[model samples]
Target: MPSYKLTYFDGRALGEPIRMILTYMGLEFEDNRIDMESWTALQKEIKWGRIPVLEIDGKEMYQSRAIMRYLAKQAKLAGDNDWEAYEIDCAAGTVGDLIDLYRSMWKLSDEKTKEEWEKKLLDEFIPSFMKNWDEQAKNTGFLANGKLSWADLYLHGWVETLEVLMGKEIVNEYPNLKLGREKVHATPGIKEWLAKRPKTVY
Candidate 1:
């Protein structure tokens, strides 16, 4: 088998897209999750002082987003032309914002703080993205290139992580977003991968 290794914590964080890509591709590799104590020690040992690194064929690649883009090309999910690739970039950037919003839950202590964050994200940020993606989806179900693209699955996996983190009913406001998510998640290869894959969280 082609050797690959992914290092991350339990939560989706930076490695979720990588995991989804691997699973969808049906590639077998090593998955390494670090405990708090070990995470701290390993921070000093790793080249970038970060987790969520991907080692493929013995070649180490850091930065989760970049790694995903590289592997997406290998998986033949990258778009056809530069214009199509631009859509992938935008979609990935948009998803990055959503994931950042989800991370806001970490330091929040009070229900008020959490609620405020959720309101801003769900009411404001998320709605804007929902509209944008809805328009995009109307043009083509895929994020771009009108086919299975990296951004398509990445956005799908991003929202899936959100649904798990936020709740299934959380996305009811955006039916198109929900439908788009379903289209990607229900893809033959992706659905099968999701079925047997590890359930790290919601």
Candidate 2:
């Protein structure tokens, strides 16, 4: 087995999905959580100076989605075939769009601008994505392929983050998405991981 070591801050954000994928694959790995001080010190040696870097057999890999996609294939969770993989990618990309929007909204300095962004997110972007995802999830209670895939896991992580940012349970408004998330949460390995994983505020 390849030795896996994941280096990230002591938070979920981008790192948790990678951890989830590893756990779901029944793979044991080093969870290297670092603080800002440690990250600053290590930044020079890290590719692209980013967290959530996964060291596989001591070879460093960067980019969270790339890592997740690679590991998903290892776990047999990517998809069954080329078309299914493409569908999964589409679903994952949609999730990525929401994440990027949230991050952009989060970085605003002006209170008015922040509030405007929040309003747009809460009233428009989130609802639109949630509605679409809820519709898509209705087919299988999973993001794609009518079965559990990495896209479902990606959606699970982002929904949690969205709930935190919105300060409420947003998924409840979309039953299919809610059911899909629950399905992901209830997976044997993931259920165990969720029970034992560190409680980070995100």
Candidate 3:
């Protein structure tokens, strides 16, 4: 087995999709959670000033999206051809938009800002995302080829993270989105993987 290491902060953030790929594959890897100070200190030590760098067999890989696609390849979950891969990437990009939106609100540190953020997050962004993704899920079902792909798994992980962050069950509003989440999560590999999945407290 190839040795792997994923570095990130406490919350799910950029590294979660890679983690989910590793988990679904039941691959053993190191999870490095660094603090703000540690990230600042370690930035100079890595190839790039990024915390979400993935190291495999002593070679460092930067860029979260690239690392995720690589891990998906290793997990044999990326699509069959280049076009299919592009579709998978497109699906992942949709989730990326939602994640960025959540991150912006998550940065608020005050009661009023947080309250305003919570309202805006649920009222403005979340529902819009649900509508878009729900339609995509209904039409595409999976990211590419109507088969489970890296994008499917990442979508599941990103949605799960959103639910945790949102502090409520939100996907019920969209049946296709809910079904998509369940399909990826219920895959034999993913189901078995989730059973022994290591818990991360953040």
TM-score of each: 0.83, 0.94, 0.82
Which structure is stronger by TM-score: 1 or 2?
Answer: 2
Query: Can you write out model 3's per-residue Cα lDDT over 1-202, one digit (the tens) per residue?
Result: 7998888886665667677788777777898878788888898888868768888987899977787888788777777888888888887887778778888876888989989988998998989877877777785466556778887777776676678778878887888877777787787766776676556543
Better of 1 and 3 by lDDT: 3
lDDT order of candidates, top first: 2, 3, 1
Candidate with the greatest lDDT versus the true structure: 2
TM-score of 2: 0.94
How does each model score on lDDT? Answer: 0.75, 0.88, 0.77
Between candidates 2 and 3, the lDDT winner: 2
Deviation of model 3 at 96, angstroms:
0.9
lDDT of 2 by residue, 88-126 (tens): 999999998998999897689999999999999999999
For residues 148-190, write the lDDT of model 1, one tens digit per residue: 7777666776565676766555545556556667777787667
> Could you say which candidate leads in TM-score?
2
Clash count, candidate 2: 0
For every candidate, C-alpha RMSD to the true structure in Å: 2.7, 1.4, 2.8
Better of 2 and 3 by TM-score: 2
User: Which portions of model 1 miss their true places by more than 4 Å?
Assistant: 104-115
Q: Relative to the unseen true structure, what is the C-alpha lDDT of residue 145 in candidate 2, on a scale of 0 to 100?
A: 73
